[model samples]
Target: MASLLSLSTVVSHRILSLHPPPLNRSLLFVKPKLPFSRTVSRDLRMRLHSQTTNYGDKEHKPSSIDSKLNPLEGAGTKNLEKVVATILILAQVWSPLPLFGLDSAYISPAEAVLYSPDTKVPRSGELALRRAIPANPNMKTIQACHSTRLFTFWIPQRKPYGTMESNVKKALKVAIDDKDSILASIPADLRDKGSELYASLVDGKGGLQALIESIRYQDPDKVSIRLASSLDTVAEMELLQASGLSFLLPQQYLNYPRLAGRGTVEITIEKADGSTFQAESGGDQRKSATIQVVIDGYSAPLTAGNFAKLVTSGAYDGAKLNTVNQAVITEDGSGKVESVSVPLEVMPSGQFEPLYRTPLSVQDGELPVLPLSVYGAVAMAHSENSEEYSSPYQFFFYLYDKRNSGLGGLSFDEGQFSVFGYTTAGRDILGQIKTGDIIKSAKLIEGQDRLILPAQNNSSST
Candidate 1:
């Protein structure tokens, strides 16, 4: 009966140990895997002992029991203290949690496990874990964890103005040596981005004004300016040989009377391949021909005599048409025609001459001998106004367009130019002429101070 009672007691104790009372509701279900020992109640301890005896026939080894009990034995003091210290340190660093006053005695086994720093065991993962915690909870920790990111945002942003100003001054100096260098110094990226701004600051009108102002204020005398001048002298001479003038003959007359004898002349053409040909008497044309006025005895003898002198001297050879107005006779002369002033021929002083019965009449097949009446006829050219007359080696042609007549009777009344003859043939050639053409005097009758008129063949000759 005594052995059976001991066996029943042992079985009851084993059953009680195997089926211990439920854990406290406030305790954590999954405790932290902290490096700490565990502590069992007295009731749990006795039940464990009985279960050990009933589990196997052999006695439980003391070393095994000691090994099993060692963890619980030390959990209450040294191991628990280390765990609590680790948790406190971690809380202080990670958050703003108060660690000054706390009852560690009331801390449960599960709560004690929470204080362990198992999550931060690895060195690299500690920083990351700390960062995950709220920064407001632990300002110092967050700052330490994200020092690089915080510093980057906290720095001030700017390029020193002093440095920029110095660069500008240096660039300006370099520009003095080489104007383009100033543009080169500008950063390429900025220039490309702010091209208009650069242009305004550099070479635009405002920039120029600024530069000028700078020069005036900084180096007054060094500023530069340029000055300039021009001169022209126009002297025109006109020469005329009326039956009344002799010693007054132009130097051209004295030199080449033969030229002065002729009525009109051509000088130069102002066209390519002869488009609008010009003559001494006429302005411009597409084609042209030459005309030679000869002093014949049948014409006014005294006039012919005076003309023959100019022709023989070659004065009128290259003379130009001085003036030409429509319905007004064209005037030609030697020398710069403007230089020679001819006095007007006044009417005969006293008209008490004897009267003759026979009237001057024209013969058969003859044209009446009348004073020159042709208007704008080919003649010599002269300048505006003057006295000393010497022909220029140039000429112009007069177009008989009859626009100027009522001003004065078409005669040598102006004393500026003289009309000797007209262009009879090759009028059509005038249309094919341009500015310049050579004017040569036709050879006169040998030993005769007159031109040999062509036969009345009626054929036009060039």
Candidate 2:
């Protein structure tokens, strides 16, 4: 039988002979010492001169033979042959016929150095190696290595659990079996890293210890905790703003003319609750009351105009203060009106200019603006709608105190209702009156059509 090297050379020669030679070449020659050299030369010469030769023409046959024997012919064929020859030479140098114990189960020194991970050993060699080693002593060495190192290796020929997936599963099982030991074995410097990996494994298995272990990853300096706290605060503020609670940020105060030239009436709220507590005439007694507000446009034109339009022909009269919580700006019309209410005429909040001339500032103490300032100011109420411009008729008062300089000095027009007349006096009186207080008769004061109060007793008291 031909040696493996010779057989390889014969195969190489057959592949080279299929291609044609380039122009201006007569013959091809390859060095003999090289494994594929002689066969390559023969093949290349055959391809180069075959085109010029005719078997029936004896004269041309000699030229063909002479061309095939020469080394300078068939440039293209020669170059191709040289490439094949080089590959064959490399194959011979890299893989030689085995001498003794050639089919060892362990990787050969040469192969270990030169072989890529993708290279596969022949099955025949694997069988030979298995037969040579009785009872496979190498298995003990493999098991020992597996015990010491975190990794495991397997020969491809070994049946049953030789696949990558199987090996990985095995490793995982081993790791989990000795989880605590593995964690303890890790160096101190790498404990955190090891802990994270361990936690991940434990998490998959549903363990409280794993969850608790994750906390160790948090910064011990409290920086991460502070950052988380800040984020929570910001998220809460964003939620408030989204919920229409941001309008309470501005001060809310309502100023309207007292009935019949009695001077302007001012009501202030210091909380989000629509109800405000009043101190008794000369005592510390407190009471809560709801104020009915009308927007007239006679005294404070801007304030009255803005307030009147919101109430009557405009859009604010009956709008709801959709964002009132207890004790904060009970009601206020300072924010975008359309957002809170819908009116006969759609009016924009921008139309209501601030009337800063009156004694409306908190500095004046007429209306104290406070943190929960939605208590008792006039505002349009509306139903919740996707478009935000659907509030009408549902109005509340902001009891919270706020600056009202911008809304205090506004004048009212003839046809509008008083924009923000105070109901505190009425509320106070009503509060003091028991639920059974009977009204004998009601009448307007002599000539003042706007002055209306509880009728005084003309009868003598016993």
Candidate 3:
């Protein structure tokens, strides 16, 4: 046994010296004493030769090299043969262990922004409408300036309940189990109002009270009606909350007219046929009918400001109304002011300020702070030449019908237009209005203090 071990060591050294360079340096030396076979198979010899040819010398062809090395196949050399054969077999199937860490494949910012799961472009009707409008080169710099975070303009303090009136509506939607928690969460400043609201909701016999009773009675139909009516209180409360606008108007837009806060525009309409609208039981039989719109500067300052300025200038006075499928648009060029058109302004939900000239991608989960889904929503008509700008004078009252709208009860043009206000009063009067109805007079009754006009152009054309 001692003699055999010594002979095997010498044969291993001889084999290592004969192969000057092996595929792997560690594979060149056989340290372990393995049993050996007198005759090595052709298959094993061919595999070792193949490995050498692939990893080492590309020019070395597979031939009878094992026969020339057969001189070592003498007494006690079986151990060396077994060691080389075992090492070669293991090397053929060996692989490096996999690594694990926090590292992952990288994605560029620009590419990430463009990436989306939606296969189609402009998935919603509003998005498609906005994209159908031609892109203006002049707006490139302005869009970049507004979207970038470099300038860091001061965003207005968010109201405790919410910035936009819509936020107040969402805050009110709560399960019965969460009623106490919601009531407790009201801000200190609004505590009194919140308490009054809570009392009215629980005991006033209105939609909220009815909703709770319906749930207790387990009536699905009544619950549905009460829930809808309860949610609708948001529109009524919006007008009463005539609180100041919660967002800051950028100084860059000061050159143009802007309303930094809420304003009320009262428009009196009369039939072109000179007929009086039916009056309520206690109201006077006036020939002209009146409607009030509460313009929101928080969501759309520029658009609301421009409309308010035009109202003060009497641009809409005596303007003829043209009825379309789902909207009542003012006739173009009727008291049309030749002022610079305001860019398409839409304040996205969860955003600090309005996005100028760009419309929200509603299908991509972006919605406006002032949604167009409500009935009697007021918005500016798109410019005849470019959809990127709102027409300076002409505007419309959207007659929203849930049946005619897209999924989720959103208006077809939900995010396409600049919705600055809603018809707070006389929503029923909208259905009574006919084509060719005349806006007998238009006036800015409130929010004159919030209107900001340039010194040189104070006539209120825009």
Candidate 4:
């Protein structure tokens, strides 16, 4: 076996920096000694996460989006809309291009109606949708920002979830309104190459994994694909910029596994009384709401499977809105997180979580059953002994409403909690969720028969 000293050196090198040398080159010097070398893959998946107290935006000089990304450099294409559509589709499964995270799930009705794209944004304060556009018109950010609106032209009209389609249209319209940033944070080279790569997702070319590979392919530093998932600090961002990193690390706030989904599931949440009431100051009118989930059997199968089974079996029925953590802006905080005697529907989720979770520095690479950033996103609770994803029962509703999160929408529980569903219909009902309220029932009304439920753990639920 290679000396412990050798392994320590490699760990040290990667921990300090988000980017690591290519795998083959990294292991080149380590002579094989024993089967123990297999441990290298497991150990190397450990990612170093970084956070900033400076929730402030950087002072960026206004420049052409094309100048910064330069996507059109080698592309001989003359059509602007097609070029933009291709790049807009190459998304980080978890990468929040500023808009993807704050869709209807995150937006409020009043704000959604009154909100307009803001051209003037603070230079050094935490960046906002308003500031995503640059002061200069010809800047790359401006073009790339507004370019997302044209995606409707390229994206197949059919989407798995109607809500996703609606959210995409709403987000794009807003992005176009302010010359906003879509998948604009990536480099021009990747953006330029993304159209072809993005199209490959449908033609059986590749899915999220392909886009991730493409991002690494554009890296001049030869950063490892797995390491590419780490969160880059400002200092690390500067380091990547200095080393010519592929994507703008600072702006990649929402980072998770980059995988697509098979289809959608509509989870109908029936109020205890099956009745509605008006609020004192005019609130949600929808008595019952459907928590729509894109049964992402592709990304986190175990998590998704467990959730599907529970919904189909009516396991979550009568689950009360036990707890509420205001700081996280979540409803129904799982009350009394019981021990994980819950059958374990084992999956490769944690094993490959580094490829998904961002802003989270844990070694486990498992992705949540669903993204927690969206509103009405239903997620399982966290446990003390097991990993953040050992969810069997219990869930919550995330409520983040805004075009721009500003300082109000920081979710500390994103990678830590498992979100398996999204709110589609009756979003207004979310306002009525309160402590002591009961989840009369949770039924998979749309895709009940289609869901892949997790098998009961025969031998300890493996």
Task: Give the top-scoring candidate (lDDT).
Answer: 3
**Ten contiguous residues minimizing lDDT sum, candidate 1:** 227-236
RMSD per model, one decimal: 58.9, 41.1, 28.1, 23.3
What lDDT does each candidate get?
Answer: 0.27, 0.27, 0.54, 0.34
Task: Give one digit per residue, the lDDT tens place, for model 2 in 358-378.
Answer: 222122122211111222323
Q: In candidate 1, what are the lDDT values of residues 375-418, reduced to their tens digit?
A: 22332222223112212222223342212211111221122222
Better of 1 and 3 by lDDT: 3
**Most TM-score-accurate candidate:** 3
Report the Cα lDDT for candidate 4: 0.34
Q: What's model 3's TM-score? A: 0.50
**Per-residue lDDT for 1-462 in model 3, tens only?**
334334334433332223212232222111112111111221111110000011231222222433444545655656756665445323322422211210112222322222221222223222222222111222222122222211121222322212222221323343234555544544567657755655554455454556546555655456456544543332223222334544566666777788876778899999887776876555665567889988877678889888888888877778887664456767665336545578789987657688988977654567776767667878887765456777776688877665544323454356778888888778778877887889999999999999988775433323
Candidate 4, which segments miss by more than 4 Å at Cα? 1-147, 150-291, 326-359, 362-371, 401-409, 448-450, 453-462
What are the clash counts of all predictions, listed in order? Answer: 82, 89, 0, 27
Ranking by TM-score: 3, 4, 1, 2
Please provide TM-scores, in order, for all candidate models, with all chains considered together: 0.23, 0.18, 0.50, 0.37
Q: Give the C-alpha lDDT of model 1.
A: 0.27
Residue runs of model 1 more than 4 Å from their true location after superposition: 1-273, 276-288, 292-398, 407-417, 428-433, 440-442, 445-462
